[model samples]
Target chain A: MIEKKYEFSGVLRFNHWVRVFTMLVLVITGFYIADPFIIPFYSSEPVDFMNALWRSWHVIFGFVFVASAIFKLYLFIFDRESENERISFFDFIKPRIWVQQIKYYMLIGKHPHSKGIYNPLQFVIYTIIFITFIFMSLTGLILYMHLYHEGLGGLLFDILRPMEVFFGGLASVRAIHHATMWIFLMFIPIHIYLAIFNSIYGKHGTMDSIFSGYSWHQKYFKRRKNKK
Target chain B: MQNRGLEEKLSKRLEELSKQQGIDSTKSIQSILDAKGFSRREFMAWAGAMTAMLMLPASFTPLVARAAELSDRLPIIWLHMAECTGCSESLLRTDAPTVDSLIFDYISLEYHETLMAAAGWQAEENLENAIEKYKGRYILMVEGAIPSGEESMYLTIGAHGTSGEVSAKKASENAAAIFAIGTCSSFGGVQAAYPNPTNAHPLSDVTNKVVINVPGCPPSEKNIVGTLLHFILYGTLPALDAYNRPKWAYGQRIHDMCERRGHFDAGEFVENFGDDGAKKGYCLYKMGCKGPYTFNNCSKNKFNQHTSWPIQSGHGCLGCSEPNFWDTMGPFEEPVADKIYNTVFGGVGADATADKVGIGILTATALGIAAHAVLSKIKNPQEGEE
Candidate 1:
């Protein structure tokens, strides 16, 4: 009983690359955006010259980000579910299996006991992160529009006034924007590490799958290669 | 050996210096020779510069040509009280003046404990002598606060009876004007934090004399030096704030001038450390940053030779300039604004910005999540039934 393998489509490749490219630029420019040191990195330019650039690009790329997310949603909604069913409800709740999968990656335990294109836990964690990002992206937009444009932003500012205290002050709000950068930073190494691991060990052609749209699967259905 | 030309003027002056010898001239001349000091040719050139320093209007630098003659620097008496020597370090760190230059030349330092080698009773006596010789003519610089209440036992000075500040009190009494340097001396910095054991207060608290408080954890050197220059020229104080600090240095708040202010007005925030928002360099008011209430010229004056202030360094302004800043400005908790509490504790601020942003984000995220959940549920209805 061989499990069928499905591949990522061209649209999926587009979404993945756009998300990666935009986020990388966002993170680097974002660092300078946090603080504006006047001292020049070299002789005369000052360290924070890039901070100005960060603000403009952040605003511009944010639109691209939103569009990309929307395209992802369209695909998720319209496309058929992968024959492998990598994402599932059981993956959301099974912490034990999640931990076990994580342990397998570290080589501290035997291979994971679960089977699927993605373990249940991977779907669960990604779902949480994805949802949070959507909310953050929306809030970020409202905040931007409220500032550069007029009319509706005032109403938004009025509503946000109470929570303004949550930021402590403008300086702290700047800090929040600064620290959120690390979350995306954390996700990057993890995402890359997993993709590489699948390529080398699982022999799934995971890296190319993102581009070529076809994944290698076992010839036998519903059974491990070694098992009878 | 005497000539009337500039060269003659120089040689004749040297002859007069050797012939009219005295203890003061002899000792200084000997010290200079021992140090392999400047040649006579170099000395005259430098003498021209020193003369300008003395005669140039203290408030104004004049043109480049006129500032060349030697001028007498105003006499300054630096008095230390209960302090950690940080203010001295701050003042002396000026690369422009260079600590060596300040100690050796620039201002006429009649007496300074940290910099001067003179010590014990001689040091104490020198302070008294300078005050007595130049009373109402020299600047009285006080570092650290003078604790008024109790025995003042927290700080001890040379041979003071009950109060630890016997020397400070005496030195302060005889000087022309006083500068309370550092937050401790100006506004009782950290020592005056809550429940001050010594019952510490700035120099202004103890005396009726005009005291200009330069408030900062360590006051900026330019503010300290520039204020002195202003005073020397004007023959009066720089305009004082309600707290008696120079208005030129304390007129603006850090909030009013911050570069990140746009993001704040726009309502962008970093929700947590190292999150996307943080990386994006949004605002930090939520993370307990204090920039609004504090008043100081740090944004403009900058630190380390106009290098960068704390906020620009990615740390919040601790409000070291304000009175009782330790108590009032500590604890980075929010005064009131955005949301995303410690832990996953969920709540939303109705701040005008947050409401609009939150409402829109909430509506969209909720709708998106709900739609995702429903569509997934409907797509696999039997899965949900399980």
Candidate 2:
């Protein structure tokens, strides 16, 4: 028999959807700012400012994406609502769990019991994604600092000048920013596929847990009942 | 005492050289200024301006004037390799010829292929003699990229057909300082862009010495002369940025110093050429202006004797001052992100942009995921068995 259990809290689900919305907006507007496919009417006055409009949206969502990512990171480290997420580090460190997870993915072994919400593979992938987010944010700020040289941009220029030099220059920083956006594009499809695969094969409410805060559990309860 | 001894030696040598050439060396700079109708007060104002441009104290105006007068004492050997003579032409072709350009003209340029009267065997002999005579005291200024490696044959100098690489290496060997005068000499300019048929490299790559890069398609006269004056006055290299470009001239982006910067912040831009915004001097950010990426004093020190620069003429900055700009800052009328990595994976055809590559990989990933899902469904006959 399947038992419904609370897996993600309200905060986790909120952060997840915020990241999803922000990423979508950021990508679309970022692409537009990069290429600006929309051209204004030739006879019309040059007051459209289509590029600037798209760029403003892009900058707004870029900040949102960074803020959401930071909140998620904070939750990962110190969220009292879900202490098990922090325990995911244990799964990442265990070689036996890694082998088992690989075997499960290859359809040669049963899914390894994870002490935390994520398996070893999931933990590692999430860690890398978070790091890429940080890199993307830094390169984004470096590019932004050039456009507006006053207020926050001025402060960022002073702080991030060394980082810009380290990456070679503004051109390299731009190239890196464009390249890292592809990382997100690559991750999204695979992430969705894996979530769907787990929900279908594992007979658990894995995909539903992202929308609702609960997932279905069975074996753990059976083992606990038998022990009682 | 040592400094005075060197000054005395320099003056005596100048007098003897003037006597040999039948020219008055004592009043060369002053006489030239006077002939050009530049008063002493006007010259002092120019000196003060130069001092400010060099980021020196206001008190150093007289020092700068003195340095300009003594500039002829310093020997400079300018070499041209694998480039258009645009940088030289820009310095030489001013309407009235500013004090800086005049100083450049007055300097003891021992052997310049463009400026020197000697040619062929005689020019080669002059270069050899200059290198021998000046030894470690003369400044070596390279005007273009050096074709290096196996493609060294692409740029051969003199009747002897010596490679530019060998010539630059030899000339810079005993030089007190080296100056890469243009983007070509600093970062291998246009010839080094994409495919790079001649395999050109910046002067710094060919020589073992530190080269001060004055990188532009043709850097402004002020920047060129200001760098020279800095070296002359301080007897040392000026502070350089990460790219070895003198920081005083290339310290800020063109976007920051642009007159239309207010429009940029106000969300006003020239959507097209000859538009109302363009006529009104709107920011050229949408017109693929590389001003944001380019670090140069073109806005502050306008080209053509401070008359107008690229932006002032309603054209966007091409980012000519940057390294590898021909490759990095292209589709010059579009944003940098529009076309990047022009020669990816060793020439995958020029049209292959970063976006195309990205979209291609993302499509393949989606296809792979679909195939994997189908295979998983087919292989797992006992559904929900776990």
Candidate 3:
């Protein structure tokens, strides 16, 4: 029998969609800032601040991205509606579960039974993505300090200057930030592909779970006579 | 030249100040030029150049000349720490002493390790006496980084073996203004790169007072002289950038001012060391020129008396003026894209760039997904087969 299960909570889906929107905006504007491909018309007066415009968009989305990540962390830790998400760490620490998951991915074993919402591999990858998010936010803030030296930027400067030095310099910080963007770009495709793979192969409605907060699962019946 | 009235007025004022200070200013600048075999015409030419360098109007030429003439009024104390004295050599080692160098010579340098003839106890005594005498009046110029914390033992100065950290702290305690004269003093230079055995730190890290960083491997003579002149002319610090470098000199990116910038805009670049494009004097961006990121006036004020700089001579900018350049802007013969840190595998993938690793993982994912799809199709021949 096929059973419908209410899996993802509304808050979790909201945070996911916010991350999606902000990541797309951040990446597009970030690449523009790095190497501005657009130019003002040659004959016209060079007055348009195209680079600055792109940079402002990038920073705005960057903050939104960070806020969404923080919200997700809060959900992972304290959200009563998603308390089971924290139990993924137990699966992450189990060597047998990791081995079974790897074997299943290698096509040598049946799909491993996961104790929580995510498998061990998914849990680990998500953890790394979170770390990358933190790094991106920090380097962005450091770079921002140079552009705006008053108010928020000035305050960040005093706090983040030592961190900049620890990272070797502003240049290294920039390199790291640009590099971390690529991580998200790489993750997005695999994440979608895996979701599709699971949805089709597992017959679990995994992809629809993110959007509709419900998924279908196989139900097992005990060896007993029906009441009817 | 055209501003003769301003020139006369400044000269008269300088004379009165000279009388008040009991120092002869009438021929002090002229005498230094004469001793160095430099003519009054050459000095005037230099003054004109300085006026232009300082971004002043033509009328300010006389003001610049008078500033150089009155350079003696500014008492300076230069300290040498964990450095090679390259900054001092760059300023003072011209085959023929330019008027700029003479102006530096004309300054009332109360104490300088490289220029002074005194040594050992006598040199120590001179430093002590100068610090005591000038008190809070002299400009303190430091040439190198100071070892921090317990690593202060790495660099000890004077006959009594006083640590660099201690010396810098003491010298800067009573300074009117402080200038970190090179990359070493500005951002700890190479000594603080990577492993940083000495635990070296920039001059600003050790002192509470604001330090105007004049950072370069060896900063241009014009930059050094221009900063000093600006201080003398205004009697207050010039505007500073985020790095505490004088905005007048470090405001614009080297890429914007570079002569090869046209080539960069046109998308013509030098791909290799001796390629046709390189021979054609194309942009060095492909060869890891850090000009786009580096903020300095190397292109505007070329080194060795406005002759040529690194980019002009077919070499990429080392980005030496920037902080921690040795660690951040290295593999200087290639573009920055190739040096992006491999964040995935950490040190194991140190040589691999983010692009390479990212593309590698992406390609693998695509292939794996394709392979997995094929395997799943073969394993499950019909619906609900499992």
Q: Evaluate every candidate with DockQ and list the scores.
A: 0.02, 0.33, 0.20
The C-alpha stretches of model 1 lying farther than 4 A from their native spots are A1-228, B1-60, B63-73, B94-106, B159-164, B273-281, B333-386
Error of 3 at B166 (Å): 2.5
Per-residue accuracy of model 3 over B1-386 as CA lDDT, tens digit each: 65566456555655654543413345488777787788778888889988888776677777788778777776788999899999988899876677777666555667889888999999999999888977876789999989989999999888999999999999999998899999999999988887899999999999999999999999988898899888766667989876899989997778778898766655556767999888989778778888866889999888887778899999999899999888788778766656745354656656777667878788988898788888876764356545
Alpha-carbon RMSD, each predicted model: 19.3, 5.7, 7.2
Measured by DockQ, the strongest candidate is 2
Candidate 1 structure quality by residue, lDDT tens digits, A1-228: 234355666777778899999887766555434333232232232334443455688877877877887777777667664433344455546788778777656444333545455675567656766775675565565446434535554555546533433443333343354445445655565566567665655555778777777776555522533311
DockQ score for candidate 2: 0.33
After best superposition, candidate 3 residue B343: deviation in angstroms?
Answer: 9.6
lDDT of 2 at B198: 94
Q: Could you give the CAPRI-style class of model 1?
A: incorrect
Say which docking band candidate 3 falls in.
incorrect
The deviation in Å at residue A213 for candidate 3 is: 11
What digit string (tens of lDDT, one per residue) describes model 1 on residues B25-64?
2234224433555454554443343224333322223221
Candidate 2 C-alpha lDDT tens digits along A51-167: 567788888888888898889889887888778788878988999989989987776776787788889899889989999999999999998988777888989887898898787
lDDT of every predicted structure (CA atoms): 0.59, 0.82, 0.81
Better of 1 and 3 by lDDT: 3
Give a tens-digit lDDT track for model 3, residues A1-228: 767878799989988998999998988887655544454343334354555567788888888987887888888888887866788889889999899888877767767676687889999999999999888889989888766768888899779978876786667777888888888998898799889877776667889999999988666521122100
Task: Please report, as a value between 0 and 1, the fraction of native contacts recovered by candidate 2.
Answer: 0.37
